[model samples]
Every structure is written in C-alpha cells, then in structure tokens.
Target chain A: MKKATIRNVAELAHVSVASVSRYLNNKAKGRLSEEKAKAIEQAIKDLNYIPNLAARQMATNQSKTIAVVVSNIDDYFSTELFKGASNILRVKGYEAFLLDTNAEQQRERELIKTVSSSFFDGLLFQPLGSNIKTIQSEFIHNIPTVILDRRLATKRWPQVISNNVTASKDATKYFLKQGCDDILILSSEVKIASTRRDRYSGVCAIANPDQIHLIELDEESYNYVTIKNKIESFLLKQKVRNKKTLIFSFKERWLLAFLPMLFADGFLNSDQVLITGFSDTKLVQTILPEARLISQNPYLMGASAAEILLKSLSGEDNSKNYEPLIVPAKF
Target chain B: MKKATIRNVAELAHVSVASVSRYLNNKAKGRLSEEKAKAIEQAIKDLNYIPNLAARQMATNQSKTIAVVVSNIDDYFSTELFKGASNILRVKGYEAFLLDTNAEQQRERELIKTVSSSFFDGLLFQPLGSNIKTIQSEFIHNIPTVILDRRLATKRWPQVISNNVTASKDATKYFLKQGCDDILILSSEVKIASTRRDRYSGVCAIANPDQIHLIELDEESYNYVTIKNKIESFLLKQKVRNKKTLIFSFKERWLLAFLPMLFADGFLNSDQVLITGFSDTKLVQTILPEARLISQNPYLMGASAAEILLKSLSGEDNSKNYEPLIVPAKF
Candidate 1:
C-alpha cells in the first residue's frame, strides 16, 4: 500500500492542502469551519492515518540524531573533533549529542546499549580503550557508524586515524640530526591507544635498540610531581654516559608537566638536549620556544569521520575508500 | 472538568490497564485479541483521549531539555561550568545541550529565537560581550532561566557569579603587604563583563591612582607574537623602575601566554616581582611554582546556576534568595 501523504488527505477531504496542514498543526483557528473540521476528521479516520513520527520511525529506524562517543568531552582534542563533526552534521540536518567515557572501555561498551535503544540514528565512536569485537556489534552494524583516531583489532569499521608514525619518525630524525645519542619517549599510557604505541614505534624505527628509551607512565600516577620525579630519575640514569640526549613526549599533558620541571631544575641545556612532541599546543609551544611540535589536525579527522558516517547513513557505504582516512601531521 | 485518564479508557474498554497501555504504545500483538483492540479504540474515541506527548507539552511547556549558552564551549573555564551543570541536570534526568557564542553578542540574540521555538524548555545563559538589554527578552522572560557570571542590567533573573571582587582584593592586599610600590593588571578585555569590572575595581580600592596600572589587551590582537611583544614592553618598564612590582592577570590565557615569555627571557625573578592570577591552573601552577593563583570555582558557579534554574522550573521561585549566588574564590 502507498503511504498517506498530506496531499492524499487533502484530496479525500476535498479541502486545500494548506488547510489540511493547518488543521493537523492545530493552527486552523477561524480558517477551518465546523463542517470542514468534521469532514477532515472522518477522512483521517477512514484512511487510518498514523502520524509521520510513528510510521516513519517504524519504517526507517532513523531519529535524525547522531551520538558522538569520545574518551573525554572536556579534553582539548576531543572537543576539537566534536566541533568538526558538528559543523558537518548540522549542515546535513542532523543533531549530535556527546557522551564522555572518561577513557574507560567498559563505559563505552555500556554506552552502546543506550545508543542502540532507539536513542540515536547513528554513532561516531572515538574509543579510549577498545577492541574490535565490541565495536563490530550486530546492533551497531544495522546503523551507520564511523570510528575516529583509534585503531581497531579488525578491519571492520570505517576509521579516520592521524599519521602518528610519520610525525614521530620525523621528530626523532630531527633529534638524531642534532647529534643526540640517547632518545627518551615518555607518555601517559603505553598501550591504551594505538597512537601512543605508534609514536613509540616511530622513534624506535629511527634509533638503535640500545640508544632508544621508552617510559610508560601509569594513568593512576599521572601528575606533575610524579612525572617530574620520573624524568629526574631518567635523566640521572642517562647522565652516566654523558650522551647528548633528546626527549619526546607523546601527548600535551606530558610535555606541559615534564618540561617546566626539567627547565626549572636545570635539566635542559640548550646545546645538550632537544625536545619535541605531538600536540597542537600553541601556548606551550610559545612558552617553551626550544621545544618543537608535530601538530596533527584533529578537526579534519573528526570531519572525515562525519563525512563517512553521513555517506553510510545514506546507504552509499563508501567505507571501501575510507577504511582509515589518514590525516597527516605537520611539524 | 477533569482530564480523561488511561484508567478510564481501560474500564470502558473492559480491558486490563496493561493491555490498554500496550495498545496505546502500539505494542499490542495478536495476543491483544481483535475484539479488545476495537473496544480500546472506541473507548479512546469516545473519551476524546489525547497522547501524553501532545497534552503534556501544551499543559507543561516541558521538553525535559535545557540549553546552556556559553561564549566558548571549548574554553577551560566554560566547560568546567558546563560539567557542573550537566552533573546536576543529569541527576534530575534533564539533558543539557551546549551553544558556543564565540564571544558574539549578536549571535546570542539570534540564538534566542531557536531557544524560544521548542528547541529547549529553559535557558542557562553565560553571555560574552552581551549587554543586559540584549539578554532581557520577552521570550526568555516566559522560560526558566538563570544568568551565570555575566551581570544583568536589571535584577529580574537569578544569577550565579564567582566572588571576583573579594578574591581580587585579597590578592591586592597580599601585594600591598609585600611592600610592592608598582602594581600592574593585564586583562584580555576590560569593561565587557561585570566580573572584569569588579576585579578592576577591587584592585583600585586598595591602590592609589599612581600605584595601579591597567593594560587591556584587545581580543583581535591577541596571539603569541603580540602577547610576547606586549609583555616584553611591560616588563621592561617595570624593570626600569628598580622597585618591587606585583602583577595580576584577570584570565588564564593571558597569564599562561605572558609568563612563559617572561620566564624564557630570565625576566621573572621571584625576589624582584610577585605574580598572581585568577584561575585554578593546577598543572600550570605546578610548572610555574612561583606564580600563585586566586582560584575561582567555575564548576560550583555552574552548579549554582543549575540549582536555581531547577528550582524555578519546579515553581519554587528560589530566585529571591539567589539573585546573585556568589561562589567564593580561593587564593
């Protein structure tokens, strides 16, 4: 059977389409006569007309809403990603709501229940600590979703990951060119996300095994005092060889916490050590003029995910080309 | 005179309340026998029963949604306030959506149209560069609203503002006690918001006209290079006097940008000058240990606004007591 449209209701009731619409919206007022109102009501009953909301929802599984799952909404990078996605989503006539998991994989999994229970039409996941199995759900597969900046355990979902390898390798190469014999890579969590792991690997790719150093700070012990203590110990150990050393932090918080303490304690000498990290930290970069950075475009990555999700929502499924949309990092 | 209830429909239809509910929700399967379905339908028509969504909306003006208006959703302070409001709102089962004004007053006024037109049940406005006239809207007057931080032209609405005056005075007094002859205040924008004006007045209350110096950095002209140049000039003049000076910054961005440049130039000597600002810069504080802060609780201010708005929505009218709920700043 054909769907009942406003025009069909108008033709059956022998009323103008505008009048039918106004009556349905409760805006008919004096424009609709008593006889005309009764006639339209009888026509609506005869047609068994269910409202657009009820029928369309049952048929399409579309809410015109999108859910953006992030590690933390308050984080600088996640918000930038949200801004990017929202810019595109709003243009496409969709509303995006945010859910912050606070870097917990368990919460992300739990959040999926809410996302799938007719709350949203689509999902955009930026998992903090997740595997492929949880992401490739039977329920999620029914709706459109795009993952952003996180590597999956399997090649199942469309993804947009920034180029962590090239940027980290370039920063490391810069340090090696400056005659640095020892390089230390410090990060908040070593294996929580592939970004950190890839950054560590990129540095390893350039340097000899003996010359490379990696320090993975546990999340529970992440504070300026603890990070300062760790860096002090690391530098103390490196001093024995009198090697010209270089330091690379994988995230902004680590760089902000570590460098100020190191500079204050006279641990950084202009000629002895060089520093750089991957973060779009204008103020930190300005403050620490000697410390260079590998700036990545989180906003672009977010926008790419939104574009892919939009395409998938339309059933175009251009996931083949965008298995992993690679946004390059700039030094 | 009383509204027809679902229980009345169930009684008239000779069906269980659960069966009536299932039929109304379109959840009734073949188990609801054909006779029961027709009977319930007839009962609904005879009683002139309407769905909860339509009647509840018309009678209660409630969408169970609140819109939080801020200058920048991504800003450190604004997001902290949003987090506080969202925490309380979520407990009350209300979802908060964010709108970033990007510091434009005109855009906020335009956004009022969307907020008024079924987009939200209430408004929590944190205006930037907005005069009270623009905020005092006939549309907004009909809704539950609470102004946060920004002062209104009239005491018509509830407000939640941090104790900018008392905190600024204490910092100035501390500087005065330190025998500081020269005092300088650097702010992002002056006279835009009452919070800024109050902070400026608090400093003026303590210092003589010659003792107090004010520099209001134009927003359009604030970048690393410009900020660095301005701080360089300011510090050069302060250094020329050979007198112990005290510096106060009104916002975190200014302090973060200014201090690093000063430190790199070996210009920030703890013995020569003392620095304090109004922000809870924990990591920044840990990094720049010499710089003290007059910490204001943005989260508490946001929570206070949420509490008042919730009260107004429930018809308790707590605005009389909370005309300007002042959350104290800790130094």
Candidate 2:
C-alpha cells in the first residue's frame, strides 16, 4: 500500500494543501477555523497520515523546541529549575526538552555536545564543569544559549545563578552571632563547581581558619557508611573539645543524609550542635523546624534563563556584553 | 560569508564526504579512526559547519528520541520515574524528551496529540485523564506507547503501575489492627485518577462506612487556610467522640503540607492520632520516624516501562496480548 501524503489528506478533508500544512505545523491557531482544523485532523487520522517532523522542521528552519540540560534530574533543585523553564517555554509555544547528565562530568560534556548540534532553537544549561572550554564542544557557540545555576570560568553566555557567596556569608555571620565557635562544612567536591567553591569562599572570608573545618565528599561514590564515618569522627572530636559546632551543609542531599544520622545519634538535640543548609524543599524545615535554611530561588533562575534565551533567539538581544544575573538566596 | 558544505569540510580534513556524513550522523563509532574523526571534527569547527539534524533524521527515518510525558515536573515521583526511564533510553542511544502536563487534562490532551503525530520513536505517558479515547487523538495509535503509574479505561497499551489496591489494603488493615475506630482519608479527587480510586476502594473493602471519613481537596486550588479549616473541623468532631483517628494521606505532597500544620497545632504528639501515607521521599520518614509509609518504587516502574517500550520499538516483543506489569509498593 502507498503511504498517505499531505495531498491525500487535503483531498479527503476537502481543504487546500496549505490548510493541512498549516494545521500540521501548528500554525493554524487563529488562521484556520475550528471546523476546518477538526476536518483536517479527522482526515489525517482516517488516512493514517503522519507528518514527518524532520521534513517540516527543515522547511520552517525551526523545530519550536528548546533543550534544558541539567546535572541531575532526581532532585528538587533540578526539577524545580526545569519546571520554571518549561513553564515559560511552554507559554511561548515551544516544547522544552529536558536532558539529564546524571551529575557526571563526562555525560554532561557529551549531552552538551549532542544538544548543541541538534535541532533545538535554544539551550538552558546547568553545567557541572567550571571550565566551559574544557567541557563544551565548539558547536555550543552555534546555538543561542543561556547558563543556569552554576557559573563557568569563561563568561560567554548570559547566566542566572544564586548569590551563593552572600547567602553563605550571611549564614556564617548568623552562626557566629549565635556563639558557634566551630563550623563544620559538609560539601561535595568544591573544585568542580563554582557554586560550591563560591560558597566555601564566602564562609572562609568571615570565619577564622581554626574555626572552620571542611569535609569534602565525592557525591557520586560516597555512601552512608563513608558519610557516617567522616561525620562520626568529626562529632567525636568536637565533643572531646566541648566545641559549640555549627554543621553547615552546602547541598540539600548532604543535609538529608546527615540529619537522620545526627538525630539517631542524639547529637541533633544537644546544645553543642546546630544545623543549616541550602535546601529547596520544605522537607528540611519540616524535619527540623529550628534549622535555618539558605533557600535559592531555582524556579526564578530557570525562568530568567529561559527569558534571556528566548530574547536572544528572537534577535532582540544582540549585545555581546553579557551580564551575570544573580538571583538572591534567602537565609 | 559563504555557508560551509560537507564537501568543504571533507576537503579541509582530507577525508571523504561519506566520512563527514558518518561523523555528523553519530554513526562513526568504531567505524572511523580516532585521528580521522578528530581531523573531521576540527575541520568542521574551523569551517564553522552546522549539520542539519532534521535532514539527518529524515535520512535515517528515526529521530533516536523518546518522549516521557508526566503530570508534573517538580515532584519526587515524576523525576524519579523520568530518571529511571532516561537511564535506560540513554544507554540504548536514544534521547528522552520530558514533557510536563502540570496535571491539566487539557494540556495532557494537547501534548498527547502533538507528540503522537511528531517524530518520537515511542512515548511513556503518565496521563491525567481516565478515558484514553476522549483525551488522546487517533494518531496515538501510530506510535508505540507505554502507560506509567495510572491506568486508563482502555487497556490497549502496556502499563507499569504500583499495586495500589494491595498496598492500600495492607495499610488499611494495619490501621485497623491498631484499634483505630475513626479513619480520615485525605486525598485528591478520587474519580479523576485510578490510583486514588483504587486506594480508596481498598480501604473501603475492610473498614465500615461509619468508621471512615474522607476529605477530598482539589490539589490545584487548595491553600493552607482551606486545609487548616477542614482539619480543624474534623479534629473537633473526632475529639467529641473521643475517637482514636488514623490520618491516611494518599500523596506525599499532602503529607508534607499537613504534617507541619498538625505539629504546629499541637496535635501530632497526642495518642489519639496515627499517621501513614504513600511517600516516595525519605523526608516523610525523617519528619515522622514512626510513621509507616506505603512507598512506591517509581524508578523501578519507570525502568520497566521503558524496557517494554524499547522491546516494542525494536520488534523484539510482537505479542498483541500485553500483561499489565505491576510493581509492588512497600508498606
């Protein structure tokens, strides 16, 4: 049997080929009547006509799709950021393609390369690598792009990031004012991400070298046993010294992992220890009502990134001088 | 400036046009030497060549892409499901496009219509509507589809869902065994989703009509004020009867919202109320350590769904009779 064509659908629907094309391409919003659109749809269904999107995309020079690449998908921060971007992109009649790198640098690099050369009109990236030149392919410059969350070493694109330094410094100051003599900072590897490094730098600026103690864990490989051993040793030492320690977590996952163990050990209720972190979900607040959290507005960041990318794609933003847009985090 | 073509890249790299084509189409694995591939890539970059993915897709007759449409993006359940599906899809050389309906039936219908007629190789849908015939276009039949989490009225497609009836029944029996006379079920609209209705039915099978009190809220519009007022009245009635009440929540979001409020109102510690619900996150366990949760393995469900879809797409599973694969939830 011969494959059904656009002309066949047009003839069966009793409409012009242009009408069927318009409906298929999603260009018949206000141009075609509802009755005509329904007839075309019905005719296409009856004829088992599947319009080749690749062919249509070539004709229009647009896929009406945007790609959002994040480090990981199974987290509150990633999902909220994606939701914010998709909310705006969807309103603009563009589909948002969410790509997850699983927080692997190699995967992030490959995904960026693949998405850059694909048919997506624009890209919103939350990269794991701090150096863009090392991670991104040359094809990245070919697409209109906006960076989200973390800043790269080179500022080639517009960025939407949280004020990690200010928020961390402010949180540290609050801890000091509360007479927190010892600060234990639990974080992922700081060198790979600007967000982590900036946050660590902020705490160091206010806290003395002796007052700060850092525990850096590789998130990909670190398990509960490792986390428990590291944290237990730290807490034991603090207990021996009778230090009033403030446990500062740089990521929500760290807090989630540590808090339960701390509570189980009866260390959470003791006056010698306090807890705080950068958390996107109310889960932390729900678990420990007294724990102050540094909340980054990921949704707003995602929306702003999408807005900038859309403007760039539309040729409204032609300036080469790109300013980093910092969304403040609340303590 | 003139546009760079495949011939220009081939000439610059001292390679054949077929080699350039193979590299552009991502078909160069083990086929092209590392040195030759590097030269081709460098030459393409030097000449500023951008390959048209649309044309390549047409030539291959495959986009190497799958669409995973869910009700919402900013949730643990949705994200885990997507991650599970993408983990498998990515390994099989396919890109997963995540589309969010935001729990809107209209948007779900429109998205289904658009994705069905588009270039996706398969679809993994967590639908909002109960009737597939009404919400889906006839074009949906043209694609290999798999349903996740929820079941539709028609069983035309394969589904990967939790054992909602069995889990809910087990939970209900546990609640009854605790000598609880009054049971309050907090759920979203029961009629709209099979999961909710199945859970409700499971509880109804064991508990007497008078023993159960249900509060149905529209998730899209419910606020703190409404939740508080409804809970206050329910508690007041339960207090008058001196009833031992079991608060059964059908969703993790509801549990998160209600737990904080209950604790604030000084009702959490009372011996009169026991809490348990369906939760995908460890947050609930962290907050209420003693609370028994019905945990659904969304990741497993998603992985299984993808496996089925992939098998169907590869023509490895040609059987018309598809058994609904049930991933059991834990209590």
Per-residue lDDT tens digits of candidate 2, residues B1-331?
Answer: 3345555777799986556656766654458889989999899899888775654554345678899999877667888898889889889988888888877877787788778877787999998756666655634445788999887765578988889999999999998999888789998888888888899998999899988888887756646567767877888788898888999999887876677556655566677889989988666776676788898888888889999999998889877766788999999
Question: Compared with the true structure, what per-residue lDDT tens digits does model 1 show for residues A93-160?
Answer: 77666666656666566566545543356788888754566565523324457888787765567878
Q: Lowest lDDT 10-mer window, candidate 1 chain A? A: A52-61
TM-score of chain B of 2: 0.85
- Residue range B1-331, candidate 1, lDDT tens digits: 2345555777799885446655765433456889999998999899876443222222233446677877765566887787788778878967676665656666567555445543256788787753766566524324567888876666777888888888888889888888888787888677788889889998988888899888787653447777677666776887787777887888876765666556657666457777888884465677667666888888888888998888888887744444577888887
**TM-score per model (chain B):** 0.79, 0.85
Which stretches of model 2 miss by more than 4 angstroms?
A1-52, A137-141, A215-245, A253-275, A281-292, B1-52, B137-141, B221-243, B256-273, B281-292, B318-321
**Model 2, span A1-331: residue lDDT tens:** 2346565777798886556656766654468889998898899889878775654664355788899998877666887788799889889988888888888877777777777777778899888767777755634446778888877755678889899999999999999999899899998888888999899999999999999888887756646666667877888888898889999999887776666556645566678889889988666776677788998878888898999988998889887778799889999
The top-ranked prediction according to DockQ is: 2
State the DockQ of every prediction: 0.18, 0.26
TM-score (chain B) of candidate 1: 0.79
